[model samples]
Target: MTFVVGPVSVRTPASSANLGPGFDALGLALSLHDDLTAEVLESKGDERLEITVTGEGAEDVPRSGDHLVVRAMNATFDLLGERPAGLRLTCVNAIPHGRGLGSSAAAIVGGIVLARALVDGGADRLDDRAAFQLAVDLEGHPDNVAAAMFGGLTIAWIDGAAAEMQRLETTVETTVFVPPEAVSTERARGLLPETVPHRDAALNAGRAALLIAALTVAPEHLISATEDRIHQSYRAGAMPESYKLLRQLRVEGIPTIISGAGPTVLSFARGIAERAPQGWAVHELAVDVEGALVR
Candidate 1:
């Protein structure tokens, strides 16, 4: 297959996974986005893989094939049985890296979608399902990728090693309190115990189920639905300030959750922007329904 003659761009929204009780299974796409643009270049050798970055993570992220976006694009092209001779990719990132905001997932989704859109008949060959599977494989989890790919709110799971997901529309309003310092998802996850009490598991399961309704038809149930008996409190020490803020907000009857892995707190209510802690940034955003789209 031939590459598209001109540059192709993709707009991929940021995702917040886990969404309280659903730990690694539920995700929501936020209005915040990252845009990636790429075009086939005619250069050779080192010049063949030029990349430019701006906005978040630009100064710290790798510029070579080690870059997550570049790797995802290469994987997509490999899956399509074709490879571009060269590439020039530009990333204008808006999502904060390592902030529990699914920045990595957005990069993965954007790269895959951008690559597919770059090849003629790529969409027909690598359909959404195939692209999604590739994305899940690359991300090592389906929750964030699923929401970033399908948009809205997604419940994702693995079946026989295959990624599966259900996307539902949600008009949930959210306000994210992002601390000045970021927390590593790996560090946060490492703090969790290998096992939990059966009663706690049961509570989480029930709340996860209720979360679906809370995000959709029953917004009032969000407070109860977003409660968790696992993960959050376990990893609280690593992000004490974040957890404290979560408790403060929840005590006030707001449905607040530690976005993704932690350090960024997401509340399912608006008009509370002034509640953010000192040195924290706040953004009010609605659910993004389009996922990743070519522009």
Candidate 2:
């Protein structure tokens, strides 16, 4: 197989998973994005790979082959049974890392899509479904990857070991309050119990279903639909300020939830940047209709 000449670019949207009680099932693609461009290089000396990253997390991310995006690209090339002699990659990012914004998922999905686009006739070789499966497998979860790959609102699940998802359109708007500090997903997850009361589980189930209706059709139900009894409160200590903001917003009749694992709070209602805590960055974002676009 021949590598495509010149560079291919991928624009991938950021995602917020577990909109409240959906747990590991619901996700929404946001307007924030990461732009990645890559091209095959002429083989010279031992420089097989070159990488540069700017914007969010650039100073902290790895510059070597083990970088998340490069690793993901390598995985895709392995699947295609071909390798470019030399490669160069550049990432311009707007999504903040470790901020419950699905940054890692975006990197993985973007890399896979970018790689597929760089190979001649690659769309015919590895279709979107196959790419999504590979992304889910690499991320170890389907929620964020589903939304990042397909866009809009996504409900993702596992069938045996395979990842499956349904995408839906929504007109809901959101404002995210991102804290100054980062919250590790692992640390937040470590605070959860092995199980929960049956009643809470039942409550989460019904609300998760209602959340679909609220997001897609009835915006009036957002406050009730976003109620959660599963994870947020249990992990509140990890991000007290975020949880406090969530409670404050809910009391004001504003629909709100902790974005993903925590430290970033998202409100369904807009015009609320003033409500953000001091030292936090806020962005009023719309739902991204197109998940990842190749150009």
For model 2, residues 3-109, the per-residue Cα lDDT tens digits are: 88899999999999999999999999999999999998855564578899999999999998889999999999999988777899999999999899999999999
Write candidate 1's Cα lDDT for 121-146 as tens digits: 99999999999999999999999999
Which residue runs of candidate 1 sit more than 4 Å off their true CA positions? 43-47
Overall lDDT per candidate, in order of appearance: 0.94, 0.94
Error at 117, model 1, angstroms: 0.7
Candidate 1 — which pairs collide?
Answer: none
Cα error, candidate 1, residue 76 (Å): 0.5
Model 2 poorest ten-residue lDDT run:
41-50
Q: Each candidate: RMSD to true structure?
A: 1.2, 0.9
lDDT of 1 at 200: 99
